[model samples]
Every structure is written in C-alpha cells, then in structure tokens.
Target: MCALRTQFRYLNPYELHKIIINQYVLKQPEDIKLLQRNKSNDRTDYHVLVDHHRFLWEDNEPKTWEEQFAKRYFEKLFKEYCIADLSRYKENKVALRWRIEKEVVSGKGQFICGNKICNESENLRSWEVNFAYHEQGERKNALVKIRLCPSCSKKLNYHHKKREIKRLKKQSKYKKKKSDSKESGSEDETIVCDSSEPESSESRRIEADIPETSNETPWEEHKPEVIKSREEEMEDYLQDLLI
Candidate 1:
C-alpha cells in the first residue's frame, strides 16, 4: 500500500490576510501590521508597500505575473510565521491544533501559559502568544513565552487596576489619619501647658512669701502663760472678800 501524500500549495497575500482575519479574530488592520512587523524576518516594509500598491491599484493599472509571484511568496512566508507564532498559545490548544493540521504541520510544539502550572498543546492560531528567545548561556538558549484566554486576560487586567485603586485609597486614608492625630496631639499639649501655667506661678508666689524662721524664742512664749495664771488667782481673792 502507498502512503498518502497531501498537496501543499502556497497561499497568496490577500488569502493569507483573510485567513488570519477570519480564523484568528484579528479585526483591526493595525493588528495585522503589528503581526507582520513582529516576524523574525524584516518584511514589514515590503508588506506595507504591497498593501499600499493594492490600495492604489485600479483596473487601468497593469497586473504582472512577477508581482503576483512576489506577493504569493511573501504571503506564504507570512502565513507560516503566523502559524508558528499562534501555536505557542497555551489556551488555544484546540485552535492551534486545527490550524496546524489544516494549514501547516511540520512537527509537534509545546506551549506554556503565564499562569502558574499551565501547559497545553500548540494550535494553529496559538502563534498569537507573545514570545522572546532568552540566552541562558553561550550556547544555551530558551524561548520565554506567555499566553492567555480572552476572559483570563481581561480578568487579570481588571484585578491589576483594582489593586492600584485600593493601594492609592489606603495611602490617602493613612496620610489623613496621621495628620489628624498629629494636630490633635499638638492641641492637647498646648491645652495642658496653658492650664498648668497659672497653678505653677501661684505655687511659686506662696513659696516665696513663707518666713524662713519665727521671731519669738521658746522661753518668751512660756512667760506669757505664767502672767495670765497669776492675774486669775488675784481676781479669785477679791471675789472672796466681797462675799
């Protein structure tokens, strides 16, 4: 039995763009430009120039086979690049596989998501994953990549914004509370000083007016008591004679 051989025909530029737009959900024209610009080869200028030529092309403009061939060659390269890039998406495993199986299938590729402990099989549209080649050592290099589903991506962005808002609010509240506490503490100190100032002054005046020692001696204080006793006795004798 003979092994099955599939025909691999190259795609034209317009067909390639249509496929990208239809399958990958790339709606914006700018996104296509970005994708082309990010490719390993520097064909962004050529692609943009071709797009400009196509835009200005009217029925009067002569169509040449050479131009068509160049467009097809670039289109094939662009498609291949897109397929390889999109296959790196960790979330779009099914889509990536479909794209590879349908469009371009060279070999198996692996994809890991930015999320912790997330790994998935590569798909056709998975090339949309952002990737960078990191050189670990002289000869050792690794591809660092990140991928996300639309929902997960949106949720992550929203949480990041929410955290920023919460952080700002907390800082504002802390500053306001700190200022209020400082102001209140200063006012309390001022009130305490004002209330104690008059009392402290009166205490000092009383202390200053106090005599150091008494003028009378102990014997002089006792002599007054003896004189009073003798007068009392004479008064008693007179009263007895009158009776």
Candidate 2:
C-alpha cells in the first residue's frame, strides 16, 4: 500500500482557518493582474493544484521541464519548510511565506509555546499562528508564524495588537510634537523679522550732531551775601550811637 502525504488530512478548526488556504505556498495564487496580461495560467501560477506538488519526483531524470521544476520546488520545500521552528522560516536563509507544520499528538502532549518571553513548556494542543507585515513600498517584509499553546496564543495575540497600537501612538505623538516645535520656531522668527524697525544711520547721525543741554550752574550768575550775627549787630548799633 502506497502511503500518501499524511500532511493535509485531519486538520483541526484552527489549522483550517489559516489566511492562505493553499496546502503549498505557491506564488501569486489569485493574481488578476497576471491573468489580464495573460502572463500566467492557473496551473502555472497555482502549482499546488498539480498532483503531489509537495513530493519530489525521484525519477532518474524529469521527463519535461515542468516536472523538473516541480521536482526542484518540492526539494526546496523539504529542505526549507520541513522544519520544527516557524520563526526560522522568516529568516533570510529560509524565507518561507505560508506553510504549516504537522500537528502535535492528539492527547495532552508536552509542547513549548513559541512566545519570545514566555516559552513555557506545557501540555496543550498547539497550532501555528501565521501572519505577515509589509508597508506599501517596503522591500523587506516580516513573515512570521509562531506555534502557540492555548493560553500563550491569547496572550501573544493581545501582546502583538497592543504593541502595534503603542508603536503607532508613539509615532503620532513624536510627529505632532516635532511639527509644533517647528511651527513655534517659525512663528517666533516671523515676529522678530516683522516687529523691530532698525533705526537708520541718518537718524542716528542727526541725534549725534545735536548740541546737548547743560546742567551746570554759572559761577557769575550766583552772588555772595554777607552774614551778620544778632549780638554783633546790636553791639555795633550801640557803639555808633555812643560815637
């Protein structure tokens, strides 16, 4: 009996709900842009539909170029995607976009949560959480999937969402503060430039050429007066009368 690929069968609800539905992460699955230009057909674009696309055709040599390409693709998948850790796939060496790992044993089995801080080994059903982030024109994108226990799944989801919100808030605050400072600086410059009128050299020269007013008292204008004591005056009057 030929044992088929046991990878896809017996998927849990969590496994079924991955964003990219293809068993294999074929490039540009539903790209209408290529279809408009007729650059690609359905089979070529969505290589997952090709039978046993995940299996490397081990003939001595591939019959056609398509079979050869499929063989090469499956080999690459085995070498790169067939790994225990989802975090390493996002690295430059691997660069796997959308893929799933085999499920853990059905019962309560020991597995480590893939959260960075809390990698607590626990007995729970583990599922791979896949997500990606890329800005519009960004060349480098972050493709990530973390195996999570039930508790850590919730915690990590909350953590990622809250962390993103916090980062955006900080960016907003920083931008607003920077803009306000620039506006204030420009306003101050405008006030300074418009407010003060510099005194002209002609005005300064006229003021300097004018004669200054004098504050000193003239010595010729003041008269010296003689002082007489009361006793001396009375004695002098009596002596004049006697004479």
Tens digits of per-residue lDDT for model 1 on 178-216? 999999988885334455445588788999999788787
Pairs that collide, model 2: none
The lDDT per prediction is 0.41, 0.47
Predicted candidate 2 versus true structure: per-residue lDDT over 126-155, tens digit per residue:
333343333233334332334445565455
Q: How much lDDT does candidate 2 score? A: 0.47
| Residue 185 lDDT, candidate 1, scale 0-100 | 89
Maximum-TM-score candidate: 2
Instruction: Give TM-scores for every candidate, taking all chains together and pairing residue i with residue i.
Output: 0.16, 0.19
